[model samples]
Target: MYSIFGVAWFSDPRKLFALVRQRLNLGGVFVFSQPPGSLGAYGLQGMYKGGFAGPAMYTYRFSYTHAMWRSLLLSAGLRRSRDLLHEAPKPDHIGTSDCPSRVPE
Candidate 1:
């Protein structure tokens, strides 16, 4: 195969890590997507602006910045590759709320 590697829901990447541990083959690379930044005021601010962050909000969305993901991957025997962070775009504006921020991503 060209690449036995794969990407699972890094959303809860640790889950994927476990799967990868059982499924991945030699030379396989597991790629996953992630959001950047830590969960906190800034992160919460961004979320408030971005809109629709869902109840499963994270402190950070950066690429694989999760210690859990790292631990799971390592525990499952997957090598850590470069994390990729993707910032969801903020809403153009809020729907007439004085929240000072727009929709969350």
Candidate 2:
């Protein structure tokens, strides 16, 4: 099993995916949780709304939407599997605080 956490946001995801695919044992699982709309596609849309830009958008590289991510995994030879996942809280519904006070670690 592997958990890539936040590193994929700033690096070459294709390279990362290739490395992970090479290193994993048969049937090994790879998992990660990215904040909603972190891709350049989404970030550009959100930029007009004054939302923060994620690393993917900042560098103008290594970006993916949910669909793109799925396709990428498949192209990397990873099988798609059903798993329970939660949707991120919508910005308008996340209480009165719209911005974080500190950068996430």
Candidate 3:
């Protein structure tokens, strides 16, 4: 029994799957939710779209389609039992939006 909520950024399903495979007790279910697309990926694409060069420090890396994400999880040996994807409107962003600044915290 685990619950993950409102992760700060996109989750690599492969990593999550690995953790689940190794740590989940028998009969346990891992519940996690991520935004439609990773914020980091979107930010990088936005920068490149606006003619800004991408740096080597981009943290979030992911494809723009569901198939790509699914492939990543499947390759990691996770079977997709169920899922829900939607094209909802974007919410007003808050806090530090300088996602690609490459500055250490």
Candidate 4:
């Protein structure tokens, strides 16, 4: 499974991750790209409802620190294979997590 600029929009990450865990085949991987927490907030109050340089709409975006991501993934029974932040070209670029479907007891 792969997500690009989408995970942040999830209203309930636990449910989203539970689904991901259920659907992932053994040895499968889940990769996602999101803005790092260091970049700060995106939407107003973590959400926005109105015109956004275009038509009127509602948007939700959540940011988390690397440590927080680790905790969340583990809680969802996903193991981090690697953190791709160091490989990113720019400092403010997206952070990527490569998680495998193996959970420890």
Candidate 5:
């Protein structure tokens, strides 16, 4: 099993997905936590205050919709597995999902 905690915000998820897929065995699990889709809908702005974000916050934080997440996983040969997935309900809480392809190794 492989897990990515709260680090996606500052890294390229596509590259990470490819790396994870290459490393995981059949039936192995992959998990990650990220900001909710709603945040993307609102245009990722004002996440920080008092000039803490400086001029390049976009390079440090990122957000995407649920559909986009599914697409990214699919492109990396992963399928969502409810049994291995969990998501928080709070509006400000980061959402999480898991993927595990059913095809034989």
Candidate 6:
């Protein structure tokens, strides 16, 4: 499955990663992109206020270091197949991971 600029919206990344791992078929991959922690607070509050003419809303947008991403993926029974963070367009970091054939116990 591919998630572009969407993973950060997950408040609970561990649960999200586990769900993705469980749904993948053998040889499947999970690819996603989001702003890295280095980029600092990137969230929807500005958009909500500007577009909807509403007060700033509370939302979850999680960012992590490269090492943190690796650990999270491993715990969810996935392995980092490739890291396209360097090649990602400005301000976004892309990560690619391969799912194991079976979920870890």
TM-score of each candidate? 0.41, 0.56, 0.43, 0.68, 0.58, 0.66
Writing each residue's lDDT as its tens digit, candidate 4 over 6-104 gives 763454566677777778876678777765554564322345565467765766565666776667777888887777653567674554544333433
TM-score of 1: 0.41
Model 6 ranges with Cα > 4 A deviation: 39-53, 87-105
The TM-score between candidate 3 and the true structure equals: 0.43
Candidate 4 segments whose C-alpha is farther than 4 A from its true place: 8-11, 38-45, 49-51, 86-105
Count of backbone collisions in candidate 6: 0
Q: Against the unseen true structure, what C-alpha lDDT does each candidate score?
A: 0.40, 0.49, 0.41, 0.63, 0.57, 0.61
For candidate 5, give the lDDT of residue 15: 78
In model 4, state the lDDT of residue 13.
63
Q: Candidate 5 lDDT, tens digit per residue, 1-105?
A: 544545454456677677777878787777665445554362233345236556644244445666676677778777766434466687756656543443226
Model 3 / residue 17 / CA error / Å: 2.3
TM-score of 5: 0.58
Ranked by lDDT from best down, the candidates are 4, 6, 5, 2, 3, 1
For candidate 1, write residues 17-97 as lDDT tens digits: 566556656666655442332444221121232366766544322233355555556776676654443333566421210
Which candidate has the top score in lDDT?
4
What ranges in model 3 sit over 4 Å off? 1-12, 38-64, 86-105
The candidate that achieves the highest TM-score relative to the unseen native structure: 4
User: Higher TM-score: candidate 2 or 3?
Assistant: 2
**Candidate 2 lDDT, 1-105, residue by residue in tens:** 433335454446666666767777777776655444542454222222224665444233344565666666667766546433454477543111111011111
TM-score of 4: 0.68
Candidate 6 is scored at a TM of 0.66
lDDT of 4: 0.63
Give the CA lDDT, 0 to 100, for residue 46 in model 3: 22
Tell me the lDDT of model 4 at 64: 66
Compose the digit string of candidate 6's lDDT tens values, residues 1-105: 767666534546688888888898767777776645535543223223235557756445666666777777888887777666445564545533322223333
Task: Give the local distance difference test score of model 6.
Answer: 0.61
Candidate 2 wrongly placed segments (more than 4 Å)? 38-61, 89-105
